[model samples]
Target: MIRDYSQRLVVQEVAPRDGLQIEQKWVETDDKIALIDNLSACGFTRIEAGSFVSPKAIPALRDGDEVFHRIGRRPGVIYVALIPNVKGAERALAAHADELNLVMSASETHNRANMRMSCEQSLAGFGDIVRLVAGSGASLNATVATAFGCPFEGRIDEDRVASIVDTYREMGMQGITLADTTGMANPRQVARIVERVLGRIPAEALTLHFHNTRGLGLANVLAAYEAGARRFDASLGGLGGCPFAPGASGNICTEDLVAMCEELSIPTGIDLLKLIELSRTLPALVGHDVPGQVAKAGRNCDLHPVPAYVRTI
Candidate 1:
C-alpha cells in the first residue's frame, strides 16, 4: 500500500546516457531506441535519451541527436539529454529534448582532466548553456559532478558545493543534482551535507546521483531521502562509470534502489520486477556482472507459492 503522506520520488532514468557510455561494443542506434521505448513503456516518466558530447570524448554515444529524434515521445514522459558545452546544448535543442542536463565537476583537478577546464571555467560555460536554453521551451538542470568526493581530489568541500548550488539557482536553474561521481559518498556525509544544502535550497529541487564503487550507493540514497531529497538519478542495470575517474564503478542500480524504496514504503512508483528483467539484459550487452542485487535475489514481495509436497513440511 502507498503511504498516505509519502513524498513522490522521481527517478530520472540515466541508462542511455550514463549506462551505455562505457560499453566496449557500440550499442546500435536502433537498439538504443528500443531500450528507450521499452523503458518508456514501463512507466518511466524521465528517460535520459542520450548525451551530446564530442565523439572524441565518448565514442559510444556519437549519435546522440539521432537517438533523441528517433525516440517515440510520450505525453507525460521527459526525454533528457546531457549537453557538455554550448555546441552540445545547441544539438540537444535542435533534436527537441524535453530537458537539458548540464554537468560540471566540483573538483578542480577532475574538472580540468574531464572537461579540460577549471571549476570556474566550467561554471562560466554553464552560464552560456543557461543563456542558450533560456527561451527554448525546455527545462534545464545543472548537475554538480563530484559533489560528494573526487578520485583526483578527495573529499570535496561542502561549502563549495553549496556555493555552486546557490549559483545555479541564481542562474535560473529549476533543479540541481548532486552527483557522487566516484561513489565516495557515505551515509553520514550524505546526511550532514544534505542537511546544510537543504537549508539554502528547497528539498524538492535537489536530486541525488550515487555510484556503487564501494557498494554504499543505497545507503547514501537513503540518507539523502531522509534529508528531504525526493529526486534521484539512477542508471538501469547499474551501468556507467566516470571516464575521468580511475577505479570508479558503475551507477546505483535502478532495480535495487526501487526495491529498497518500495520496501521502505517510500513510493518510488517503479515496477521492480520489470526493472530487474530490464537489468538482466544489460549484463550480456555490456559483458559483465552488474552490481544490482534485486536481479540476483528477488524482491521481498516476490513469493513463490509452495508446492503441495513442500507444503507438507
Candidate 2:
C-alpha cells in the first residue's frame, strides 16, 4: 500500500524513562535533568520524562521525582510520566507531569509476569487511576504492551488487543499506544493490526511503539504509517527494554527514525544533528555502546572529501 509520506509524524522521545529504566548503571539525577533539558530544546513537543514505579523494580530511574522537578520545561513541550497504578499516578501528578502513561500487557501471561496481576486486575486498577487523575489537568495515555506478540503466549489475538483498547477508551483515556513489546511484529501484521486499531481510535490518538529486536522495527513503522498511524515512541540511542518481558531488547531508535523521516521527506520537526549528538552521550552515561545507526552512519548529506589518489586516478 502506498503511504502519504508527506504527513507530519509525532515522535515521542522515551529515552529518559524507557531507555534508562533497564540500564544496569545508575544515571545521576543531575545528568538526567540535563539530558531532559537538552531534549526539551530539541523541538520535541512530547517526551517521556520519567516513570513513578517502585525503585526496586527499576533502580536506574529511581530519581524520577528529582529528574522531573529539576528539568527545564519548554513552553510547548509536554512532559510525560509513566505510572503503573494509583500510587504512581499520584506521585507523577505531584511531580507535575504533563501527561500520565499507563501500561498493561495484552497477553494474560505477559501481564501476570510483568505486573504480577491478571489482565482484569490491571484494567480495574487503571479505572481507579483514571478516576484519581480526573480534573488534574494531565492527559492520560494507555499503552497496550505485547499487542503484536508475546514471548510466553506467542501470537496475541487481534480481538484481544481491540478489547484492551475498548477498556482504555471506556476509562476516558485521551491517547492509546500499541506496543510491539518484543519486536515480534512484521510489516504485514503491523499494517493489519494498525488498520484494526484505527477503526476504534483516530489516527492522531494512536501511537505505535516498536523494538528492533529482529531487525523489523523500521519496516513495522512504515507499515503502521501506511495504515494510518501518526505517532510513535522511540528511545534515544535505542537504549530500552522490558525488565519483566524476557528476551526483550532496546526500543526503536529516535535518531534512526528521524533519519528515516528525513529521507522520506516526512516532517518531524526534530533536529537530526542534535539528536545524534545526544545519542553519543549514552555510552558514557550507561557505560556501554548504544544500538542506534544514524549516529554511526551519519546522514546522506554528510559528504566526504575524495582521497587525493582517487582524485588523481
Candidate 3:
C-alpha cells in the first residue's frame, strides 16, 4: 500500500453546525458566531458554519441566518452552510454562504429517517438545487451520508457509493463528502473506498467526514489520508452526531485530528494551542463534557514541570 503521510491535510471545522446541532441546550446565536469567528482565525479554509434546515428539525441552529450574516468573515476562509432542499439552498444563498453542502444518505432507511425522502427523491431535489444555485457564485458539495456503513441497512455496497459520486460529478458539484455517519467504518474499509473514490474524484475535491463512535475516527482519517484523501471534517470537542441514526456519536475532534497530523509531521495550518483553548470552552457551551481527548489531555508536546517530590528526591 502507498503510505504517504507527508502530504498536508485540510481540516474543515464543523463545530458551529454539526457539533452543536444535537445539543439539548441551545447554543446562543452569539456564542455560535463567536465560535465560528474564533475558528476562522485558526487557519481553517472551510468551516461549516450552520445549516438552513427547519428549526423544527434542528432547533439549535435555527438562527443560521443571523449567525451567517453577523459573523466576521475571514478573508481566505470559506463559510459553508448545509442545505437539504431547494428551500434550504435558497436560504443559504440568501445568507451569503460561501458554499452549499447538500447531504443524502446512501441507505434508503437512513435517508427516509433523516431527510424524509428516498434516495431518488433526494437526487431529484438536488438537480433542482443545482439549477437554483447556478450562477449564484456559491459552490456546491454533495455529501453522501452513511457512505461506509448504515445503522439500519448495514454494509452499503462500494459500487453504490461510486455511482453516487459519479452522479455528483455529473451534477456539477464542486466537492463531494463521504460520511461515516454512524462511525461503522474501519481502516481497511476506509482505504479501499477512498482509493476507489480517488480514482474518480480528485483528492482536493473529496472530503471524508468520520465519527468517533467506536473510537476509530482518527484511525479512519489516517487510512483515508494514506489512500490519498486530503480533506476531512472534524468538530470541536468531538461534538455532534446524526440524531436520526441510532448509536451515532459526535464527529472526529478537530483538535485531536490536528494533533495527530502535527505528530506525524503533516501540516494542517491550524493553530493547535488556540484550538485547544477553544475546545476547553465547549463543556460550558453544551453544559456537558465532550468526547475529544487532546483538549483535555493537552498535545503530546505539552510538558509539565518535574514533580516537586521527584526533584527533591
Candidate 4:
C-alpha cells in the first residue's frame, strides 16, 4: 500500500494519567505536575494529565485535582482529565481541565468488570456529565474500551462497536477513542474497524488507543493510520495497563511511536529526542524498567562510533 509521508498525526500523551494510574508506587503530585509541564514543552497539543476518579479506585492518581490545578499550562496544550461520572466531571471542571474524557467498554462483560456497571448505565452517567459541562467551555470525548477485542468475550462484533460510536456522536461528543484495552487487535482488524469508525466520524475526531500486550501495538497503529486515523493516545515509556483487565500491558510507548513516525517521515510535531530524555527518567520514577524500546536502543539516527577492532580488521 502506498503511504503518505506528508501526513501530520496528532498524538495525545497519556502517561500522566494512564501510565501512573496502575503503579504501586504513588507518583508524587509535584512529580506529576513537573512531568506534565515537561511534556507540554515537548510540542504536544493534548495531554491526558490526570483522571478525576475515586481515590479508592485509583489511589495513584488521587491527587488529580492538585495535579490539574498546579500544573504549568502551556498556551496551545489541552490538559485532559478522565471523568467516570458526574462527580468526577464536577471535580475535573472545578480543577479547570481543558477536556474531559469519558470511557465505557463495548463488551458487556468487560464493561461490567471494568466499571461495575452496564453500558447503558455508563451512557446515562455521561448524559449527566454533558449537562454539567455545558457552557463550561470544556470539551467532552467518549472512549469505547475493548473496541477491538475483549479479554473475556474474545471477538467483538463490529456492528456493536458501530452502534456505540453512533451513540457517542448523538450524545454530542466532540471526540471519540477506540481502545484496544488488552492488545488483541491485529493490523487487518485495526484497518477494518478504523475505516468503519471514520465513516461515522471524521478522522480528526477519532483517536486510536492501543496496548503492546501481544507486541502488535505499533503494527495496529500503522494500519489505523493508513486507514485514515490521525490521532493516537500513547503512554510514556510504555507505562500503563488496565487495572481491571487481565493480561493487559502498557500502551504503545510514546518514544517508540514517535520514533517510528519519524523514520516513516510522518509528522507528529513531537520531539523524539525530548521524549527519549523523559523516558529515561521513568524507571527511577516508577521503580522498574519500562517496555519502550527506542529509549533503551536509541533512535535510528543515533549512530555509534566504530570499534578499534573493526578498524584494525
lDDT for 262 in candidate 3 is: 90
The reply for model 2, stretches above 4 Å from the true place, is 242-249
Q: What TM-score does candidate 2 get on C-alpha atoms?
A: 0.97
lDDT of 1 by residue, 1-313 (tens): 4324278778888989998987888889998998898888777888888999999988999999889998998789989998889999999999999899888888888888878888788889988988888888999889898999988789899999999899999999888889998888999999998899899888778889999888899899888887778888898878887665545567998888888888777787677777788788887777777767788888887798878998678
* lDDT for each residue of candidate 4 in 156-271, tens digit (9 for 90 to 100): 99999999999999999999999999888999999999999898999989999999988899999999999999999999999987554445466999989999999899999998
Separate clash counts for every candidate: 0, 0, 0, 0
User: How good is model 3 by TM-score?
Assistant: 0.97
Worst 10 residues of 2 by lDDT: 241-250
RMSD versus native structure for model 4:
1.3
**Per-residue lDDT for 199-300 in model 3, tens only?**
998999999999988889999999899889999999998988655544545699999999999999999999999999999999998998888899999988
TM-scores, all models, native as reference:
0.93, 0.97, 0.97, 0.98
The superposed Cα distance between candidate 4 and the true structure at residue 106, in angstroms, equals 0.3
- Candidate 3 residue-wise lDDT at 250: 67
Better of 1 and 3 by lDDT: 3
- Number of the top lDDT candidate: 3
Q: Better model by lDDT, 2 or 3?
A: 3
